[model samples]
Target: MPGVAERLTIDHVGQRGDGVSLTNGASLFVPYTLAHEIVETERDDEHPERRRLLQIDTASPERIDPFCTYFTRCGGCAIQHWQPDPYQAWKRQIVIDTLAQAKITCPVDPIVDAHGAGRRRVTLHARRGSDGGLRVGFAASASHAIIAIDACPILDPALDGALDAARALAEVLKPVSKPLDIQVTAASNGLDIDVRGTGPLPTAIITALSRIAEAHKLARLTRHGELVLMRVPPVVTMGSAQVTLPPGSFLQATAAGEETLAALVLQLCKGAKNIADLFCGIGPFALRLATKSKVTALDSDGGAITSLQQAIKDTKGLKPIKAEMRDLFRRPLVPQELRDFDAVVFDPPRQGAQAQVERLAASKIPVVVAVSCNVQTFARDAKILIDGGYKLESVTPVDQFRHTPHIELVARFKR
Candidate 1:
């Protein structure tokens, strides 16, 4: 039997933005809720810690109407109903609390609004329903089920046709019956679409996909990053150089996010003559940093390194850039190799740069700027740097994935 309805008061929002309450010494998590609000819900019998919010008996002043109809169902954005001022503060506080837990003390600046013009890239899932119809959209909240949608409000205006293009391409691949993951990016040339999960296709099917790409006016189309069709190279402008994005290459979620983060890194390394960029994906920061300083960019992705090398060749006036393909986790620059650089900037993945940070802790880099997407890992890495005689200067949180719990930050360290 379903649990009976009950009234609960939300104590506060958890780190994932769920409203939390203490009951019987255990935590109850309710979605789409806020602190100090009373809500009527029923606890799931199978999942006792979870509750389905039935109604808001007493709404908080911070609550506002969600912008998207699929806010709760799509699972893409959380805390959309909260007021902006408080929401921004909550994001900044997340960093503050995480650092405190790591016993790290420093000035954490306010969160930067980097969700400019909305997300420039989006990955949509394509699945076929039991009724034999194709469904293309994001996954439902907390489930693998797909929620079909035609438009997403959080996408940039440039990606207006991304969903449609994804649908058309998915339709051609429907006969294969394999679930697909389509990534669409708004490039300077045009929309770049990459279709994944479909194994090798017959030449006829490949031809069909190419025709669909042409019909949709896609700049390029790729299957598992192997070129399927190409009308023009997908290019993106970063600082003074124009980078041709490799198929499915890593890029900042929002265009403004890249600019904001690069600006902060450049400012921190103001007087740096030579800087080393570790985990440099496609040279988002290195390209910009090179405008005034020499840069050595390194990443594990050969495609990204090739793209960076190509971008530098086309653009002149850069001091010097040596883009290399090296696995930093296996071979972090030793102190001897790091001695030549005046400043070091590393923007690592969500796992953080544990291996590289360990090496960095052993080094004597003068100025180190760390860019990260996960707060927990950032704190861990920051602790390592602090243990290595680095002074924690300042930290700034950048909110590029707006309306979600995801946050990115840039931290400056000095000796």
Candidate 2:
């Protein structure tokens, strides 16, 4: 295939920050080519691959050295090469663009950085075999091939060793016998591991894992400290109260992130006598809020609701709180259902709270706090709230996933 000889000028950055342009009516996406930069390109017609930048004729001021050695090969983060300030500004701009596309007017507050941020709770992937041994890492960008990594700088230090140890253990296990899926989480005490597969692990494999665990000084967890391992639920302590989380139950990944989110929820409540927390997983925010006022916690996850109920029972001096399992996606809280609450808070999934936002907006709730991981979805939902007569008060962007395009945002709106 012949490489294009002319120097191509980058017009602008796309959603993923790649330089986007058109060549003979075909879309070309060239990475590391910033807006206004000129570059030589190669086209792979067979793969339908976008034109790839072969040489840079000019560089953009926004570029910077990526901190990670594996930045290009590793698929976990896309924008690490960009300067920090411009990167953050671009993220905020995307949020603004989404709202603008929806024709919504609201103040986009400056992004907020959390202390000790970038702590991820759960990571999922498959194990790969290499000539040296077994290798574990994130899948390549837009591909299923595994990209081996020695260390991930973004994760909490404690959780770093878990991946290395897991890879080592995979080498010892029989090629066809071991579980393909592994999940690791960091707890207050130590690291926890969950291996999921078709059947029970062989005795030899378990012994090998145990030896690896002891050698690495990985925390030997108790039923209370390890929720992901045992057949029965794991017990978690909140203040003086103890709650049990069933296997596969959702919990906040980092103690810092949870505390930050909880504090924000309380601030948004702002002394409301009654508050409704939707999709309140394990009462992280709802339980904390119960100290100040009455709270109604609702979630579709039965295990989460059960844990929240147990928490309410164990803690004293908490205001009246109720936990219910309702699939908000299918049967969202109607306007009449929300009539009794003065304020509402929602922390929905990446898809954002489309159904819930519509229902909440129709309810005419005085205050609404919407937390989301996806900025585009958050902006869309914010528009819904604004259309319902609530004015956007503030937006705080939390960098929960550093070195990546992923952003966590908390938006407050008042009627």
Query: For each candidate, C-alpha RMSD in Å?
Result: 1.0, 3.7
How well does candidate 1 score on lDDT at residue 397?
A: 98
Candidate 2 colliding pairs: none
Where does model 2 exceed 4 Å of error? Answer: 2-7, 22-27, 44-49, 115-117, 122-124, 129-133, 177-179, 197-256
What TM-score does candidate 1 get on C-alpha atoms? 0.98
Note the Cα lDDT for every prediction shown: 0.93, 0.72
lDDT of 1 by residue, 1-415 (tens): 3768878999988889899987778889998999999999997765768888889999999999998988899988877999999999989999999999999999999899999999999999999887878889999877788999988999999998999889888888988999999999999989998999999899999999999999989999999999999999999999999999999989999999999999999999999999999999999999998888999999999999999999999998888999999999889889889988889999999999988988888888899999999999999999999999999999999999999999999999998
Give model 2's TM-score versus the native structure.
0.85
Clashing pairs in 1: none
Per-residue accuracy of model 2 over 2-67 as CA lDDT, tens digit each: 665545778877777677776577657876667778888887464454566688888888877788
TM-score: which candidate is best? 1
Model 2: lDDT equals 0.72
